[model samples]
Each structure stands twice: as C-alpha cells, then as structure tokens.
Target: MTVRVLVVDDSLTMRNLISAALRQDPEIEVVGSAADPIEARAAIKTLNPDVLTLDVEMPNMNGLEFLEKIMRLRPMPVVMVSTLTAAGTDVTLAALEIGAVDAVPKPATATPEAFHDLIGKVKTAARSRVRARSDAPPREAAPQNYSPDPRHVLAIGSSTGGVEALLTVLGGFPANCPATVVTQHMPANFTASFAARLDRVCAPTVTEAVEGAPLEPGHIYIAPGGVAHLETTPGLTPRCHLSVGDPVNGHRPSVDVMFDSVARLKRPMTGVILTGMGKDGARGLLTMREAGARTLGQDEATSVVYGMPKAAFELGAVERQLPLHRLSSAILELCADPAVRSVA
Candidate 1:
C-alpha cells in the first residue's frame, strides 16, 4: 500500500524539495503541502494523510507546539524536519517527546543521498504507531525496596523510540540510584542535548559519557553518538573508555559493544534491551545472560518498535520480558535479589 504524506514547512523551497524526494519513492505519495501549522491543520483534516513531514521552525506556530496539539487532539505519525543547528536539535528532541515518530535533519543542500535517507525515515514513520498523548498514564512510585545498589551497574540499549522509553525508565530512579549506562542510536550532535534533556526530567544525574569518566552511583551516562563505542575499563575504579573502531551492527556507539564490555566486568550487572529497530544488542545480551547477569527485554505490546527486544527474546538472551510500565519494578526486584547479586 502506498503511504500518503503531507509536507509542512514555512519555506516553499523546502516543501518542494521534500515533496520531490518523497515522490521519487514508489511506495510514497505526496498528498499535499502546507506553509505553516494553520494551513497544515486544515490539510490534515481534509487530506487525512498517513504520514506528515513537519519542519521544526514554522510561522504561525512552531512544530513542537503543533505536534503537541496533534498528539493530544488527533494523534498521527509525524516525522520532524530539523536543521543541523543547536536550536534545531533542541526542538527536534522536544518534537520526539511530544509523540513524533522520528526526525530528519534538513541538509544545507539536498543531495541525492540525503533525500534518499529522508524518504526512508518518512516510510518508517508511516508504519509507526501513533499513540494519544494521554495514553501514558502517571507512573506509580516504585517500592522502597527498589532502591539502587552502589556495586551494581545497569546497562540499557535502544534505537528508534528510545528517548521516550529511556525517560520513562530513568524517571523512576531515585537520586542515589546505581551506576547506569545507555547506548542509544542517534546523531552525534543530538546525544549531548538528549542527555541534558534527560537530566532535567529525571531524578538521577544524566550526562554524556566521556573518556575515563568515573562511573558514579546515582548518575547515568549516555554514549555519545557518531563516536567510538563506550566500554568499561578493567580496573579498581569504574571508568568509561571510548574505543575507536569500525561500526558494529551499522552503529558506531553500538549496543553490542556496550553490553559486551559490561559482561566482562566482575560487578553485578543488569542488561536491558528496549524498543529499537534492529538486532544489534542480541548477541551481546546473550553473553551477559550466560555470564549470570540478570537480563530484561521490553515486551512487544509496550514497545514502539519491537526489533531489538524481540531479537534478544528469540535468542533466549532475555531472562524475562515485561511491559514498559512494569520494567522499573522488575529492575528493582532483580537488584534486591541476593541470588542475582551473588552472581557477580
């Protein structure tokens, strides 16, 4: 089936360029184009397009605000078009949190390769599930016994829908939670901003991981995108080490790399595979399970994209699979279990 798309941008040139790129794909059909949110709102009602490509900066209303409205009133798949600037990155992240399916950076010049990439992202968005903003209910506080352990480490990996998933998981953590690391597939320019956003919303301190940074309890470290893999060094002090290497599983800061490195450590570790688009972390998560580390994977019903967790589950790597709402409690239970902790 062809995917019907509506392009919304303040610039006429950008709308034309995006329409042209999308038209090149046989599976995509450009249904309409709008210059701003007001026009886009009408077009949405009339056209009822399957996917929307929205510009971050638009007149009449900004993309983030419009996106929030859309998610609240009539949720639909939206892919944000962003510029490669600091401000644009910030807005794009906000768009994702507001239930946009994905984001594509607007190139300075629309090259063939860039246009092709945008087309791919739009197609992916077309198939994504668009939930109402109210679908995410307030999370009940985790039980008192769910507190973190100073000696334990938690490693999480995700891709496509990771930002929201990570926020949901880390939001439940206490100020003195265990040392945690994350590998999420994203552009290099976006990781720091994403971490900063996570820090503001979460109780734990969230920051992008740096070379030789000491892993402290109650702090979360995120792997910088477009850089080397983040790995743990073998030493008395838990330090993060960035290694320059070829991209594994088509990602530089690959989830497999982080999980493998953590498996080598002597401390108690918990491995979690969240919603993502590929099988990058499956093998490494299997290794972690074989090494007696407690492993968890997001269940299909709650995942935005079930690829990574499904892969891990099929491989017998994930010891337990649960919905997103229950994962925080499960993690705490594993952390508190003496049998699980004794495996270190």
Candidate 2:
C-alpha cells in the first residue's frame, strides 16, 4: 500500500526537506504540506493522508495544542519532529501523550544522512493504523476488587512504540487490578510525564516508582528514569526498587533488567513484552518463563517493529502471542482469572 503523507511545519525549508525525504521512498508519497496547525487541519480534511509529520514548535497555537485538537476531533497517525534541546524533548513527550505514532529528534546538522533517518521515521509512521479516540468510548473508572486473579505481580516492558501500546493495555485494566510494574525504555525526565499520562487514561493509579514503595494491587508503578532495572521484594511483601547501573544491551531502563528482576523475585508473574526494536527483553523473558511465569508476547502482525517480542518468542519465552488489538483484553482475562491467584 502506498503511504500518503502530509508535511506540517512553519518553515518552508523544513517542509521542502520533509517532502523531499518522503519522496525518496517509492512506497511513500507526499500529498500535501501545511505551514502551521491551522493549515494542517484544513489539509487533513481535504487530503486525508495516511500520516502526518508535525513540527513541535510552530507559530500561533503551537504543535501540542494542534495535536490535542487532532486527537479529540480526528485522531490519526502523526510523527513528531522535534529538536534535540530540553524544550524540544518536553514538547515531544507531550506529543506522545496526545497520541503521536512516534517521535524523531531533528538532527543538528542538516545533512543527507539526517534526512534519510527522518524519512525512515516518516515511513514508519505511515505504516501505523492509529485507532481514533472518537471511535471508542472514553476510558471509565473501574470497580473495586475488579482484579479476578491474585497471583504474582503484573510485569510489563515496552520501548520505541510503547507509549501508545502501554496506554491501550493499562486502560483496559480495572481500577483495582493486580500489582503492575512497567519499565519503558525512555530518557531521564520523560518517565514522570509518561506515568502521569497513563494515570489519566487508565483507571489504575499510575506513578513513577520510588525506593521501597509497597507494591499493591490496583496500582501501577513505572520504573524511574536513568535506571536499568526495577525489582520486587521477595517473600510475602512486595515493593518497588530502582537502580541506575550501566546500560544493559545499550539501554538504561532496559526490558531485560526489569524482566530478570521480576523473574527472580516475582515468580509466576504475568510477563507482557510489547512493541520495540532490538533484543532487550528476550533473555529476561526467557528467564521469567523458566521461573514458571506465564509470558505473553505481542504478535508481529500488530507490532510496529516486532523486534523484542519476536526475539523472545523464538527463544521459547512467550507462551502465547497476541495481536495488539486483542492484547489488552487477553491480559485482563489472564490476570483476572481465579486459577492464577497467589497467596502472600
């Protein structure tokens, strides 16, 4: 399928660069360009492109406001192009909260190599089929004692395309769901906002983990930034622990680190590995399976990249593979089952 893209930016130079970059790929076609969000809105109505490449900082309303409007009115796949500055990172993360498909930092040097990478991001965005917010009912608060299963902890690991994936799964969880811990590969300063965003969209109270916070049912803890691992306390009482050690497999807050910790301390845990690139979680997931955990991997058909989950599945770490559309419900059913209950 050919990908039709709409380029949105305030700068004509950027617009041209983005359009040129997409045109390089035979599979992608730049259908339109907009100088600002207002113009982008008009273009969206007319072109109905498959994807949009949006600039974070723009004249007038700014990118975040536009993104919010887009999400509320006409949700679609949008790729954010942000600079490498602190302010840019802030805005980029905000874009993710507004439901952007992905984000790419604008290169410092405007070279051909940089343009190539930008094009790659655009192509990836075009391939995504984002579920519009208007299509589904707003997430509602779940009931108390909604968790059916009382077994081991709920472990979730995600990266790259994780922001959207995590929201979808957590939103389906009950207000009083099982104790859930997540490690999403992200830079420092981003995790707090990410957790806050999840809390808004999910019934469960979500927050970035702090040292020795008791792990309780119905609450979700996100691993703190700059850490490679988050572990649970052994025996009866479980709690959260964060560490800022060397990068494992080239990533801090690595999936492997979290999974290994869960495997060692939270046996029989429900392991969920979502969309990402690279092999961070595969080994740790395998260890989790060996420790008698019920492991689930997102199927390739529904993943943005399918690198992590595919690696884990090939290593026999995954007991079941599910498409993204079905993963949320599957997780709820699995964790909520009475058969999997664990006595403290």
Candidate 3:
C-alpha cells in the first residue's frame, strides 16, 4: 500500500530534503508540504495524508502546540523530526505526549542520509495506528500510579523503536506510581542514553539499574546494555542481577528473564509487552500471567512492528490488548487502587 505523507516544517530546505528522501521509496509518497502549523492544518484537511512529519520547533504556534491541536481535532499518525540536543529532546517528548507516533533524531549535519532515515521512520509510523485520547483526563507531571496498594510491580520489555515508546508510557505515570523495571534491547552506549532520556522526560526517577540497588515505587530502573539480565531478588526489595551468563531468547537483557524474575519474586506483577520486533518477551509474559500477574500487550494496530506483542498474545500471555494512547490510563487503572497489592 502507498503511504501518503505530509511534511511540515518552516524551513523550505528541510521540506524539500524530506520530500526528496521519501520519494526515493516507492512505497512512500509525499502528498503535500506545509511551512508551519497553520499551513499544515489546511494541508492536512486538503491532502488527507496518512502520516505527518512534524518539526519540533517551528514559528507560529510551535510544533508541539500545533500537534496538540491536531490530536484534539483530527488524530492520526505523526512522526517528530527532532534535533539531537537537550532542548530538542524535551520538545520531542512533549510531542509524544501530544500523540506523536515516534521520534527520529536529526543529525547535526542534516545530510541526505539523515533525511533518508527520517523518511524511513515516517513510513514506519504511517503503517502504525496512532489515535488520540481525547476523553482521558490530562495526566499530571508527577508519576501517578493506578493502584495505591503497592501489591503489583510493573515489568515491561521492548526493542527497536522502544526509546520513544518507553518515554510515552512512563511520561503518563504520576509521582506515586508503582515500582517498574524495563528491558529495552539496545547496545551498551545506547542504554545509558535511553535511560537518561527517560529520566529527563518521565516523572519517575529513571536510571540504569545498578547491582544491589533496591527497587522503589515511583522509580524506574532500566537494565544496562551489557550481557546481563535484571532479576528480582527476595526481601520485598529487588536487586539488579547483571550477568554475562547467556542470552535468553537470543537477548542478554531478555524480557523473558525480567518477566520470569518478576513472576518468581513478585507474583501478581503487571506484565506489559510494548512494540518490538522480536519474540523475546512472549514466554516471560506468559509466566507472569500464570503467576497471577495482569498482562497487557500493545495492540497490533498501535505497534511499530507487532512481533513481540503478537507472540505474547499467541502464547496466551496477554489478558488485554490496548492502543498506545490508552495504555497509560489502563496501567493507572490497574495500579491506582490502594487495596491492590502483589500476591508475591
């Protein structure tokens, strides 16, 4: 199927560059172009493109503000074009909260290759269904837990396009959310960067898990990129287990490893398998479910690749499937009850 796209940016050079990159792929067609949000609004109405490539910083109601309006008025898939800078990162996160599908970091040089990558991301985002949550109450800046009882911990796993997905899910958390751990398949250098990115965007304190550190509510620990798996230890407090032992499901920081640990250490934990391209988390999520954990999977329509969640669903690991927009609220609803506590 041909994926139609609308490129929105103030820079004519950027607009041309993006258009050219997308045209190279036969599957992607540049339907229209807009200089700013105002023009983009009209273009979106006229062109009715399948996906939108939005710039983070633009004149006349910045990209983020415009994106909010678009989500409110006409929700669709949007991929953000973000600079690889601190401030740009912040704005990109805002875009995700406003219902952007994903973010591609723009290279400093802005070479042909950079725009080509952006085109690829746009195409991928276009294939995914990203709807806006118009009725859900606006999330607060603090980490909010759906359950107040502290009985259930949340163990999530993802890969490939996980950076943006993780941030979006965590950003919806309130200040007093449940203890959470994540395993996003990535290389050594990228995990730290990803964790730092989440720390900056998410309300909960996020950091790369260190050996022996206790898991705390409102704190999120990301596994390091090395050949180690994070497992929950005993004592009502969990410790990080970093090992070069072996790759589970062809992954060092395997989702199965984390999920299994949660099932063993915190039965009745909540298992969330987000967008990914592999089956690493499927088995582990099943174990969690069997252990009485509530399991949630990102629906196929909202997934970037749909491989992981599909596998988990086939394995009967998922008790519920939801889109990206509703995931946070669903998680909150599962955890917000003060009487809810983990059976583990």
- Best by the lDDT measure: 1
Candidate 3 local distance difference test against the native: 0.78
Please tell me which model should have the higher lDDT, number 2 or number 3: 2
Q: Candidate 2 residues 226-333, lDDT tens each?
A: 654677767676788777688898778788988888887744478999987778899999988898888899888767667788889999999999876667666666
lDDT of 3 at 322: 89
Candidate 3 local Cα displacement, residue 343, angstroms? 13
What TM-score would each prediction reach against the true structure? Answer: 0.93, 0.72, 0.70
lDDT of each: 0.85, 0.78, 0.78
Cα deviation at 76, candidate 1, in Å, is 1.2
Candidate 1's TM-score = 0.93
User: How well does model 1 score by local distance difference test?
Assistant: 0.85
Q: 1-344, model 3: which lDDT tens digit per residue?
A: 89999999889988888888788889988999999898999998999999999997888889988988887888888888877676776677567656776777665675566676566567667666555656543433433224444655788998745665676688888666778889987644456667787888777789998888787787888998655888877566666666556888768888889898889874347899999766999999999999888889988876767889999999999999987667876776676554654211
List RMSD in Å for every model shown.
2.7, 5.0, 5.5
> Over the stretch 1-344, how does candidate 1's per-residue lDDT look in tens digits?
89999999998888888899899989999999999999999999999999999998888898888999999999998988898799888889988887887777888776545676778777777766678979986654634444456677788999877888888888877666678899998877899999999999888799999999988787899999887899987667688999999999989899999999999888888999998877999999999888879999999987877889999999999999988877876776666536444311
Model 2 steric clash pairs: 151-342, 227-253
Query: Model 3 residue 148 lDDT?
Result: 45
RMSD of 2: 5.0
**Winner on lDDT (1 vs 3):** 1
